[model samples]
Target: MKLMKDEIETRRTFAIISHPDAGKTTLTEKLLLFGGAIREAGTVKGRKNSKHAMSDWMEIEKQRGISVTSSVLEFQYDGYHVNILDTPGHEDFSEDTYRTLTAADSATMLIDAAKGVEAQTKKLFKVCKMRGIPIFTFMNKLDRQGRDPFELMEELENLLGIRSYPVGWPIGMGQSFKAVYDRHHKKLELYNPDNPKDIDIISLSGPDDPKLDEVINDEGLVAQFREELELLDVAGDDFDVDLIARGELTPIFFGSAISSFGVQTFLQHFLSLSPAPTVRESTIGPIDPKTREAFSGFIFKVQANMNAKHRDRVAFLRITSGRFKRGMSVKHVRTNKPLKLSQPTQFLAQNRSIVEEACAGDIIGLFDPGTFRIGDTLVEGEAFEFDEMPHFSPEHFAAITVKEALKHKSYEKGLQQLTEEGAIQLFRTYNKYVEQQIVGVVGVLQFEVLEHRLKGEYNVDIQLERQPFSFARWIDGPSKALATLKEKQRNLVTDREGRLVALFENEFQMRTAQDKYPELTFYENSFYKKSII
Candidate 1:
């Protein structure tokens, strides 16, 4: 089957990546406003009277003023069905951000004018580069005094190994910020902070339009702006669509996310330039987005306790091809069984509505009753699977147990749900009779989140005892070798999936074990091998 060209061209999906405090959430709110998805834009930092951002729906995010989990939002703008993946900017949750990127067709890189490119941005950019996804740069917070435009462009090239092509140029900085000069259209867009949504567009016959002089009363500023524009035209990289599509060059736009300046222009140009959903790689081969074959998609994220009142879980899926309808039955590629998807929902942050139908490039959530996991594939025809998603190795370890015997059931249930959600990894001692559990995480903040959720959502408290181990490896070998190794190693355990593992205090300890047990093999990630059904 083949999809109509018009239907395929109307869809766009991308993710936003940025560093902490870089106004990523603010940009998301403003984009939603332009799309008519929301009537009033909400601040990321919730106020007594103002609503919080639609994308940061978690209670923990509202309380902490930072996104801790990835959120998928879909809306309509300019006759395009846009799917936005808003990722966590905090370095503590880089794993979540990495997983979210796997589902995006392209990425928007947000850089603060004050801070050129922070540590987290570099890490995120490396992932995008590795995937060879096209990236668009938005220099945010131009209303504040920041680095020179030339310097910022130079930094992007020097650090990220990518060329920058300025699609628009700023007139001035901070309080003196007046307007942006559109290089492509050769026009000036006058800024109005008091009414940022109302932009006054003026055509520029040339740099010496008398109307420009009237709008820019500051003679000195106008002269300086003209000189900069001339310099940029002469020295900047030419706007090459081929280079941008290849991820070799990024078009730059300057704006203030809070005041909505330059946001609408950026949105319009982005929609016209960005690519629609392309091809996805699977075990069978590459799956084309334009194909109208039986529906197929994979789960990249599994969230539990989305509705705390109901204690529900939702698995987020990105449709790769064909159309999806409510009450459709799809084969679970891993389990080799058919599942009737009865309640597929679309997200407006935490507020969700049932989706009657969706198509390729769209993201929708399916209700999961402990039957789904990240990386599970749903298909309607012959069985096939996508490439396995990366499972990050945990760097921190801890021993944990419930504080009270009476709360053991609730504690166990909470632990199982959270682990299944990929918040943390759970392991047990090889001695099956032992009741204590060991946990591993990429960061220390996960421990705090686990404690908060256990007490707040499950009515159970936990006691965490820090462990000296800094690394863990899953063991693979014969039963006799495993027994002999466990007998010699003091730190040996088994994961919830019943896989044998060993904990090491540091790199040296892990090396010693590898040398002593030459017959055994070790795996840093449990999902290293692909087992297709």
Candidate 2:
């Protein structure tokens, strides 16, 4: 077996983002297929019950055709190691997407060619911008009926605030879509199932080429195309045509992913153009929970494995910097918990390989930290602790009550376990009666998963109640009496200009310690202020 490099390594990691069903998972599967990870491609809708798609892990995801939790997959192409973070596209899982993005250097923003840029796509792109991550846009579903690619390009620029040049151009649209003209190669590559081993790139100005004839269909487009060709002819310039191809114009690729058409070309494009880990900038910090100067890595994901007889936990890690080795003790940032590293494993889907140590900027796995919690940073000493990635509080919340009266007591334990694994957040309301609420971004789809997992994994059945409007305000005084009286009482509210004026609640608030009174908290309360997330 060939050993990896001794001088650490070079790699490229990217989180794939898209609105739901824009084909992010399918695109990921195609990339993996081309990289020789799987023997065959699995469809989102399966023919047989036995064949499971690699990207969809949870039973709920498989049944619903959506991604809930993010999954990591690795493949080597052209001597470059690529780590792919496949994330959920639904708005409910947006926080998960953002947290996962922190571990990546760049992102591939996928949009449906038919629908153009959707709401979630724009939101995720802004997040990438905020994190200073470069983005590569993939206009997918070209085979579906849609507007012109040019219009889509305009939308991308206008909405996402990014300059997108096509890397490939589609030969046709809808059912007629057959080939992708490579802008870089200056040739049209036709997809051939029988010739999967070698893809043939054909020249454009050749004899009676059937592919070229098939591509130049629309009369208006044909006229413009010939005009461009003639302009190049008059310039006394030997137009390589490839130069036009090399520029950042969108390279449209055609073919159906279901048929495995043009999939190989996409893989070729990724291996050729996608930036690897070595090229990306690295951020280093400490592992200690008490301080920020030490080295600590954050575990962004944890999966509970209670499949049949196997009971184990899979921990996903993004090492900010420094080094972590097996048997070394590290502090868990969230709860000030200390953990002894057992074995560090490099995970690829379900398969894992043991590694002696993981260094800065590396995304790897840890073998069962028994009591692992998501968002906990593993640091060497007290000084290396850093804030967890900023996860948006769940927008839509629901009150879940036990369906079976007898199971109500056990539900909290099971639900708590789920939340501890970072599946969701459980909030205990300080009302007269204890009301445990599951707060999270609610995509209609993930709620299904939440209910399904509750039943399947925990064997608990619960009812859900969609919540109503709620907001938090910083008060000048502290008292249940003050909190109660602040009704219709616009006392004082602060604005962006730092001017405090009348802010009203349902009533006026009372003062506990009039001296220390209302300090006022904004969107950030205790946690964000403490961790600086």
Candidate 3:
């Protein structure tokens, strides 16, 4: 009981978000390196003989050297149980990234030194801001020749509409990159990339210490470093924990993730300052982590065949209240059924170990035999659903065709499992399931992954014919009202659950259909928030 509350206080669940190639995976590996989760860090993109990143466990991810799906990684550091959600940096997989954000209490926004704020960075940051989560900014790739730190800070305020306070500022960047000066400690931590773990710190009287000149050797570089530090001291925003908690101000740290410089410093400060497991919103209202006694949680992600040999599905559940113990029977709120949570495991990417118990803010994977879903709430005492996750209006659609008609079993199995995992939505032209299957996704890259996975995993090769349609709307209200609108709308499809969807080729067509069928309610978002029960 008391131990549960203490454990909850020490939990910090967060997600790392950034644009493609901004070093999100590299930063994630470095954090794991500091946490002692892995023996040595691996590169995001490696040679044929070299090892790929641990977080990117998928074969396609290994081949492309990019994270197209979010993976959960947990580790312990300095009395804190940290759960790191490594999300996809590619915009094509932004929908999966967005859903993962719902489970996180805070976010770590990684920014490239050269490209200040990118299109995908802006998009993910907007989602964080919308969720009102505290964001910690890390200016990565300082080992490479990049933009001025001051310019990057200004761009953050001007473009992202957020202020920043640098806790550790870089002494130099690119090949001349030396180290990060700890502003709070008034110490210059020397960068020793040769043996990064053997860190050396010099306690300075101040930034103007003459001893620094001898250590740096470069007089001009020392002068510029002191000047920048002086300007930042006098004019920078004051460090405010309250503002950071409110997502208004971000505490920025400068370092190169690949070199493993300034990572431990960042991790230490982040744990002490970042928010822990907090109150969760539910249908019954706020569920406080400390006060609620009954074990309850919600499924934010369900992935299939994480362990290829097992052929199983794992549901990633974020415990909202109380503690979960292995083999406990709990109410599956969606189905109004009871379930024995016998096999609960914690993760280091695909590798897993059975966990005896887990508390709030902890993510545990339940061996789900196709019984769990995203946003399904499980509870011990009472039943209530968490707020529904968004089902974005698809911007792209394609008709799927299996290469071998004889392999219908494998093809059907692949399509059903993928759709169930929320990777993509399946739709048909009529009420019949056999009618041309149209798959809709938030981005185009998903189509590629879909094709790749079906062939790779299920032994079913597929060809996707692109559709002319751009958007889909779920129909509501009178069926008769859709009669006239359906005549004008050539493509009226039925979604997986048999909901009528009017596929529009353009916004003009959507507007025209709306004007024609004023009585019918057309919802752009296809949200099935309610359960069958």
Candidate 4:
């Protein structure tokens, strides 16, 4: 079946985002099931740290029960081919999320019913908004204890400054949670968790049943919904309340992912209304290397997987303009290096297959081509220059010391391979001991994955100790002078925050400096402390 409708010319790609453990993984599994991409949803808790959970691929991630990396899953939905970037929710893995957000046209911000907006959720949402991507809120886990949808909706509005309307309400929550009625379909679907096949649908639009009205009235929710309906009618399809006001069609659906309660209904609504990728205002560029005048594709990330004798390194790219074909050579704007494509592959979780060609608005993986790096642009012309890849300065740094360090040659080779995958940052200072830092968006799960890959793949057991008086200091002078000063001050004090505060001399700078800096001492106390030391 065609993934997109005949009339729909654009593709729709959405990224699922949430705080860690907000059931983002569960939602991804359900969507895959609805599309028949997977026969059964994998339970994250039951699987080995490395094997089962679709998103939790790294060994440490599995053992620690966190998502350390991002995974892309493409499937056909409604009339559009939807590519869902399931991203990691932890802070440590936020860099991955940031990069993935750039790859998506739209975002589905997931919130836990029990835990409304979290730190990671807030962080990723900002990235999406900054990119001007339209977002839809998915308030999940109604069956679990925590905040309710109404509260979450308000929090989202206040915290994120986004205007959203709830498309569905929970039928029941906690223990009595069962199913939800589609606001659009007006049909109630009862959930049968033990036997998912036993789904029952009922229309509640024109029913005169006393029992139904009684339940609605008792909850004081019917009047609320009627008000909502009136407001929606006033709001209209143009998304402007004063203009067309065609009435609100953002139907909300409810479901329990574990029991597959409202999975089918959610999928049906998602397919019916979610816009395709082509409808999105995509960035355009040329593909020809010589004319570099045209739009080209940008590679966001790369992953290496051992399949057979031919191990594959996949480069995930978004076409800004032009078309890319298999076996074509394109120049990377960043490195001034040309990469020959073996094939272009699209992802379904961990599985990837070759595609004939890719056009603008497509996000697919290009197969093994050496000399590829994240944020590299694939352009046709040699002279054309595209924008640099989005900058992500690592905020958190954990210096790892190997308990059983590898041989020098092995260590160098392994670190090179690891850094190329954007896993960690390794630094050597003459004064500070040699250290390997796992730097990126951080989450508990992300760190776990780094640990696993380092130990299992790199054959190194390591301990991470906070660096002594860490500060990313830059002198407001020449590079030579700064380097000299850095060397002099490298071991002066363990007060990184104070050092930075002294440099910036701003309140915001001091506040942020203290929050992130582990060891801090006020400059005023420096003299007294120096004398005491």
Candidate 5:
């Protein structure tokens, strides 16, 4: 048990989130570089370039140079077992990002220095706050001319409603960019653009060291930098570790992820400050990692057909409590049955190796034989589910048809499997006399992915025509009210589970129905409340 506790404490699981093109994948590769997970950091320059990001393993992602799904990688750094959840940064994949956050104990919110708080970043930031996950900000893209660090800090507080404390401050901007002042150690790490290969550490007598003046080579810039430091010292928020753990404050680090500057410093500081796997909430109660004896975990994500030859699926489970050994039998809490725990694997993106044992905070991949859903639970002892996993309402809708009559079976099978992975939502509706298959996604790019996967994975082609409906709301009300709603609007459809949904062309259409049928209740998401997401 002591050994198990040690294993849990040594693990640090976190997700990196940002808007698209904020250098998120770049930062993940650099962190992997520090972990020795890869010999060289793979560049995400497009498929034709023959080098793709290590975190993005999907072929579609390789071609598009954008991540549409989350990737998990586990490695060891400085005696700490690190599990990095590399999430999709695009706004289209925000739902995927939200799902990935549940398995993570904390998150590193990457921000583009030029564009401080972006739309997607703000959206994901709220989700992080919903779960109360501690956020550490990395103001990226310092290699180019960018925003004022002080303004960026203020934006975090004003726009995102979180205060930030800089662990290190940049010395200059743009071509004159020189070093980062490590406030804690009172040292300067110089940056040389000509030789941007390694970090140069220089001992400074103080912030006003003449050695720093020699490095900057500009007297006016030195005076301005010193004044900014004095102002920050006088007026900035005090470093409160407790507030940081509570997600109330963020420790900000400024660097360019593309150039790999200040990344090592960020990694070293992040490992020391980040929390280990903490207590996880379940239906029964709070499950404490320090005391629990039985192995338990929940499935946060499910990926299907990762390997073309194997045509297999993986259920990514984050162990909540206790220890798991190979070939152990655990109870499937959702189905109330015993499930054999065999063939557990750990990942470095798509590359994986079978792990003999894993403890709390470790995410392990179990070979899924089309059984696990997004929120299913597996436990060795008490049976309780972690119920916070949410079902988001899809905004974009389309009607899909099999391109060939003979390929109906293939289309159905492919659609079922893809929907099961939670890449898109499946629905059924009627057009005149025939039932039509409808697919919905939060973003339209998923439609392309759906088409691509159907053709590639299952060898079926689909004709996906866009629908006018912009919103879907699950209905809960008296049978008479629902019947009336369907009769009047003819906008009613059912989700995969046969839950009745009203597809509205616009909000006005929804409002007209609501005013007419007062007995009916509309819900944005299927089961969870608004705050839970």
Candidate 6:
């Protein structure tokens, strides 16, 4: 089975990751603008006369001006199909971002020119590195005063252990900011802050082009930029296209996303350098994106209630190979059952519409009515499964009880839906059938989101009581050992799926269990050899 070159080469799927307030959302809007996805770019913090960012559609997000979940946006630009995964920069939602990264073939790491690499950026970078995905660096907010370019490069190398190659260089810092020298094309892109959509492009014969001084306007700045360019060319490591594809080296671009300076230049260069949809690993073998085989994809995310008018749950599937068409019958690998995908849709964040057709590297949303789970694989006829999606261990625990006993049904349904979405983990005590249930989450902020959604979506108000347990481990052993552990441990509980687990008061208690019950195996996080559920 073979696909047309145009079909294969025109698709580009990537993710954007950064620390909070690094202008990541702004950069996404500007890219969409270049792609003609939107008529006018919307600011994240909507002004009195401006619209809110399209990607941040949730009501809470619009008010808070932060992305809490990952968004998938598809648009066409210059004869290519671009799929951008705009991920949350907030550290509390890092788990969601981690799952989203698994679906991307490449990543754009945004760094605040003034703050450099921060904690969340490092964590997200590690996930990208683990997948060996190519990363392109964008030093954002160059319009503001920031650290020297030389210092920023050094920090990237030392902190990430990856070599940096500057593709473009900024002329000046802060108010003096003017333009960027495009090293790849030997061109100058002059910035026009007032009319960012219109840029002045000047071609240079070489670094010594005499017209450079005239274009630069400032004679002193021209000489300084020329000297730095000369030094960088002579001393910097040679650009290796292969290394950049292997995630060993990052091509850096300087830009101001808010003002849209240098964004188009970065987008053009990024598409040229980034790899297209590649092969994915499966139980059978590597599935080539160009193979004209049957359609196959896996669920990376399950979002509930994208539309308030209807109680809908959407399962986001990243097509790994072949083509997808509406009303096609495919096998649900996990359940070993065939399902007719009647309503496949494409996303513009929360807003979506039915799509007639899609192909590999495209992210499609399927209408799920309590059937789909994260990491479920779908195929036309193949009987193989992809690698399991990883789940992070939760550090915080709490017991939740509905304030109004009459709303218990709604509370239960909401909890089940949210837990299935991986918003939080649900657990019940084995000692007694209590009305209150325990929940675990990677970060404490998740509790707030859980409460907010329960009240707003389910119309059920709940009270959350913080728990002291710091560690949870899934326990497995013979019936004798299980019974003995359950009798001795007051903190024993079962998850939503009825998996046996033991909660420890502290690290000391966990160690004591390990020492006492040598026959039982304790797992820090639940993982499947084949299916995620």
Winner by TM-score between candidate 2 and candidate 1: 1
352-389 per-residue lDDT for model 4 (tens digits):
78887655556788764456667666777643544444
Those runs of model 3 whose alpha carbons end farther than 4 Å from true positions after fitting are: 193-198, 431-434, 483-488, 528-533
How good is model 4 by TM-score?
A: 0.76
**lDDT: worst 10-residue window of model 3:** 524-533
Candidate 2 overall lDDT versus native: 0.60
With candidate 1 superimposed using the best TM-score fit, by how many Å does residue 138's alpha carbon deviate from the native?
0.7
- Runs in model 2 deviating more than 4 A are 1-9, 46-50, 192-199, 203-256, 278-296, 306-308, 322-324, 331-338, 351-361, 367-370, 403-410, 432-441, 470-519, 524-526, 531-533
- Stretches of model 6 off by over 4 angstroms after superposition: 1-5, 46-49, 193-195, 433-435, 528-533
lDDT at 416 for candidate 3? Answer: 89
> What digit string (tens of lDDT, one per residue) describes model 3 on residues 322-430?
8899999999998999999999999999899999999999999999888988889999988898888856888999999888889989999889888888899999996
lDDT of 2 at 361: 54
**Per-residue lDDT over 1-533 for candidate 1, one digit per residue giving the tens place of the 0 to 100 score:** 33555666888899999999999999998999989999888887645467877888877787778888999888899889999999999988888899889898889999999899999999999989988888999999998998999999999999999999999999888888888888889789888867876789899887768888899898988999889988987987999999998889999999899988888889898888888888889889999878646799999999988898988999999999888999999999999999999999999888899999888888999999988888998998888998777678788988999999999999998998888888899998877567569999988888888898899889999999999988889889888988898777888888877877888899999999999999999889887455444
Point out where model 1 deviates above 4 Å. Answer: 1-4, 46-49, 478-480, 530-533
Candidate 6, residues 382-423, lDDT tens digits: the string is 688787787877789999999999999999999999999888
Poorly placed runs, candidate 5 (over 4 Å): 430-433, 486-489, 528-533
Each model's C-alpha lDDT? 0.88, 0.60, 0.89, 0.58, 0.88, 0.88
All candidates: CA RMSD (Å): 2.0, 7.4, 1.7, 8.2, 2.4, 1.8
Each candidate's clash count: 0, 42, 0, 40, 0, 0
Candidate with the larger lDDT of 4 and 6: 6
What C-alpha lDDT does candidate 6 achieve relative to the native structure?
Answer: 0.88
Better of 2 and 6 by lDDT: 6
Best by lDDT: 3
Candidate 6: 10-residue stretch with minimal lDDT: 524-533
